[model samples]
Target: MEIIKINDFNNHTLSESDIIKRILSGEKELYEILLRRNNQKLYRVIRSYISNTAEIEDIMQNTYLKSYEKLYQFKHHSSYSTWLIRIGINEALARLKTKSKVLHLNTAQNLNSNSILERPDTSQLNPESKIIRKEAKQLLEKTIDSLDTKYKTVYILKEVEEMSIKDIANCLNISTANTKVRLHRAKHMLKEKLFEITTNVDIFEFGFSKCDDLTEKIMSIILKN
Candidate 1:
């Protein structure tokens, strides 16, 4: 199939309806536009669950393939990006199940609780300052990575991805109430993890300074492939 040049499709002007119509009318190349548009977001989504770089790429590819195969079944009730997120979540979950990776919900909850106590105070600094904010953001990401998959996915979706709880519920195929509960628990776990990391150990000494950077490296490697 010919790949569409997604970089050329300006985000504000790209019409999902038009893309769907094109794909349904035997323009398979149009699907690449959707893939490219959603790839970074989906990569972040999948990475929250699967830490292994190779496995994340594999799942991402599988998600797009599955989405293409099921395109005819899409009813257009939700946005195409939302539908794609659902497919990505399902693909990740299926792979996790096959690999027998335990989610360890309780562990995540515990870690979040620790984060709150460990978080550094930047209240006196200019929140608008880019350099300070960058350091603060990196600290926040480190705490996030310490969370278990269950909490990590919800937290990343709700916080990092800025998705609504309703959207997250649809992506996870869980009720909104459950999503809220998991998010609450995940937050507590992240707080706990951060608290432990900050109070008990030197982050530099532990070599965790590179945890946030690892995701970018992983993404670079995937794109290179």
Candidate 2:
């Protein structure tokens, strides 16, 4: 096989710090790998806070671009994924803050209600199985969505993203004990036994097509710089 291009993804061994150094030193294309690597986790983290698809994509784009702009300042104190997740969380929360203010000003009527969960395309499954799986997924998503913002975020990070408690604490800038408390509270609020059944379900999926489109949009902008 030909040697990998400067922009191509190759070895799995290089740490994100190594890639960031190279990107800073002038191999900017490598940034695409970082974007792709963290896209799903970042998307899920943001999705747990915000349900609007358009706004989620906007925040994802801004997070990728903002991270690239501030890449030089990354201190390596945490994994790049953690750092990026923190940025995505901040952006989503900020958007919500601004939105809350707008709603407060307008005292608007009820806003549009659109579902963020993707309905499973169960073409191969029998009708009965399809109905069962779909309802279960909806109920699970709604249950998780019912959580307060603080608890929902920690819950998604711990249960859905499969992150450790310490990592979740670091990302949220909370103490380990606080992280554990929030997670415990979240599980309790979700009710017992629900977590067990929903363990493997992919709730707010960032589909491959959606990911590629977002990645390319950001990549195109990066390459232009």
Highest-TM-score candidate: 2
Q: Kindly list the per-residue Cα lDDT of model 1 for residues 99-191, writing each as its tens digit.
A: 666653332322222222133565665534544455566677666777767788888888767789998888888899999999999988877
Off by over 4 Å in 1: 1-7, 101-139, 201-225
Q: Which 10 consecutive residues of model 1 have the lowest summed lDDT?
A: 108-117
Q: Which candidate's lDDT is highest?
A: 2
Q: In candidate 2, what are the lDDT values of residues 65-153, reduced to their tens digit?
A: 99999999999988898999999999998998998888763332222244334544847987556666666666777777777779988
What lDDT would each prediction earn against the true structure? 0.74, 0.79
Q: What does candidate 2 score on TM? A: 0.72
Instruction: Determine the backbone clash count of candidate 2.
Output: 0
Query: In lDDT terms, how accurate is model 2?
Result: 0.79
Global lDDT of model 1: 0.74
RMSD of each: 11.4, 14.1
- As a TM-score, model 1 comes out at 0.68
